[model samples]
Target: MKTPLSRLGNSGLETSLLGLGTVKFGRNAGVKYPSAFELPDDKSLASLLSLAADLGINVLDTAPAYGSSEERLGQLLKGQRHDWIISTKTGETFDGKNSAFDFSAEATRQSVERSLKRLKTDYLDIVMVHSDGNDLELIERNEVIATLDQLKQEGKIRQTGFSGKTLEGALAALKQVDMLMLTYNLREHREGEAIDQANHLGKGVYIKKAFASGHLVSGSGEEGQLSSFRHILGKAGISSIIVGTINPDHLKQNVRALCQASAGMV
Candidate 1:
């Protein structure tokens, strides 16, 4: 099957409509709350990433908060750097033991430098401010925006964005961002207002938590809930929906959901 790709905001970077999320690579989000469908080891991760690139999945989202996900992804995709698009986050620094949220200019700069080292890349396709709602204002402050702009100018980051929990928080930084990653799924639809605002501003919208953290896929409730959710979001004009799973079967199932939802449209 041919995967569809779309331009991110006004940037030249084009990504698959369904991106691979790397939150489960290194961290154990607990045994009860699995990060993705299948938790592959280092070897498996490398193979899966290579397969994803062959399948034309360009965008891969990761963060420092997701355990050693960024580092693992970097190592796995080391030789295949130019084969895919890498999207990562900053605003928080982790040193294996401690994590401190710092949106200051100096911190942001340091964060990107660390991310670059971890990803084994000179420049990132997109760098998002991973703010947890409370730091929305700090993300929008001149220092933060100026730092991101500088990174773009320096060719260290192609574009800048943010991941917010609320529509208001996303909107607060819309003017300074080229993309917005937020939760918009079947069970959680409150982000529609912010998505509309982002679209109007010509910002790319990358939907996260699209299945409500795997609730729709577990089959504990409605049977066609996942399909319905994808259909609704596709009709609503969302650019992409990221569904991650470590299990290949489950990953294919998620792709099936997307296929069924957009059967006629695509």
Candidate 2:
């Protein structure tokens, strides 16, 4: 059976319960994964994406900070642009060794424009602020959110959101953006209240680090994954869990776990 889809808040978008994260697709440096690995070749990525589609995965999460991910996705996904919903980030950029942040309206607009060109799309399904752990200050400034609103009006982005580390920032973002991405998994449930609030307000919530940065996935087994998935996705407000993996078998395993999780929910 295919993975089920649900309303991502009220943005008029429906996303699979599992979203493919493209961080490993673009960059492997300065990451927090359990192990280090080489970047997959183009042929490998193509096959992985093909498998993702076969498994009914529709959402692709990428970021400008993720090295060449946006450009590569633009090339890899050419001609099938409308088939997948692409979510990219702004407000942060990585230069192999370090990352920088600039949330001025000018910088955010430039970032979105560059993302459109890199993704080879005229508009984005979702664009989020790549918070630099300074979520509260950024949200208070309102520069990034304002630019995203202008882009939405100009048909450059379908929805605006924030991927932040702090609860304070998450709550503030929930009030303004159509979507929210926060770290929520079996190990960490600090963002639970924010998830409920976002759901109550009819806003979409996307989960990050659901597998605890792959720490929990190592020896958990499928049954363990099913339990974790149920715990994370069982919440009322979670729109999807963003998992980044280049392994085809792992992808299929996640989908299977998701299907089982959904069944358990019913």
State which candidate has the highest lDDT: 2
Which residue pairs show backbone clashes in model 1? 37-245, 37-246, 37-247, 38-246, 38-247
Q: Residues 93-126, candidate 1, lDDT per residue (tens digit)? A: 5555666687788878988998899989999888
TM-score to true structure, per model: 0.88, 0.97
List the candidate 2 regions with Cα displacement exceeding 4 Å. 264-266
Per-candidate local distance difference test: 0.73, 0.89
